[model samples]
Target: MLNPVMNNTKWYELRLQMCALVPPPTWSTFSTAGYRSQPDREWFYHFREGGYEDILHVDIQVETPVEREIVRSALKAVHVPGEETPSGFRVFGYLHDGQGAGYI
Candidate 1:
């Protein structure tokens, strides 16, 4: 069996950078009321799962109204260029994925 793999190591870097924007304290209710931020592997799959070829698409779901601005600022602070969307931001970059080396 083959496992999904992100070909670009930069994506990993970007994930960490972006994840840092959201402090650990607020991570409990960052996304939505019941949704927790999976700092480890959450953001990485957005591009591959959504079929986005040239951008890092992240959907920010806020538990409160104030989180909107926080998310906006974080999106701009990310390393790559990104545009705000209704649900989140579309970070312009190359985030491709493919099957990892299959088991012998």
Candidate 2:
């Protein structure tokens, strides 16, 4: 998706679409949380030069292969402008298929 960090409006809209297209686990939670402040490293969270508050961690859960494809398509369609993210946000997905299709 458009490096949601690039635009607030786009991010908001995309976030809504993602939630609608791919629902997360009911038991899980949504957050903009990340390790931008931590010394460790991770790809699930998009870390930028900005502060941690700028990050948005939208970890979603897809229930089916079709849903997974849609989510993946949506991610591939967006064109993120500039090398640096305006804010500090990223999208993630977890497929609960038997194969253990973890994070995306």
Candidate 3:
């Protein structure tokens, strides 16, 4: 059984660390602080097995050149244990169990 509190905390810390690692360049459309503040505009989706898996499976549309480049770079730099598919990224492990994988 997964501990919801611990799972959320791990994912939150991971996301925050990733946001810190790849600070959006001045020329980019969004700021790291802004991105951190707004969950809707999150760089990646985090989920547990059998819980809203659809969020991870939805296609993320990167409209502009800047956005595309940033997304690509972030995905490459931020190590999320998962496979990137045509539809979306699929995470392969659990957070609460000390497994690295969590966010999509």
For candidate 3, which ten residues in a row score worst on lDDT? 24-33
CA lDDT scores, all candidates in order: 0.40, 0.37, 0.37
What's the distance in Å from true for residue 10, model 3?
6.7
lDDT of 3: 0.37
What's the lDDT for candidate 2? 0.37
Backbone-clash count (model 3)? 0
TM-score of model 3 (CA atoms)? 0.32
Collision pairs in model 2: 32-57
Once fitted onto the true fold, the runs of candidate 1 whose alpha carbons sit more than 4 angstroms away are: 1-10, 21-58, 94-104
lDDT for each residue of candidate 3 in 1-104, tens digit (9 for 90 to 100): 33222234444443454455334222111221222112233434432223331222223334456655565555555454454444334433223455444343
Report the C-alpha lDDT of model 2 over 1-104, residue by residue, as the tens digit: 21233355544444444545424221122334433333222222332224223443443344556655675565445542212112222353222234222212
Off by over 4 Å in 3: 1-10, 17-39, 42-60, 83-104
**Winner of 1 and 2 under lDDT:** 1
Deviation from native of the Cα of residue 41 in model 3, angstroms: 1.8
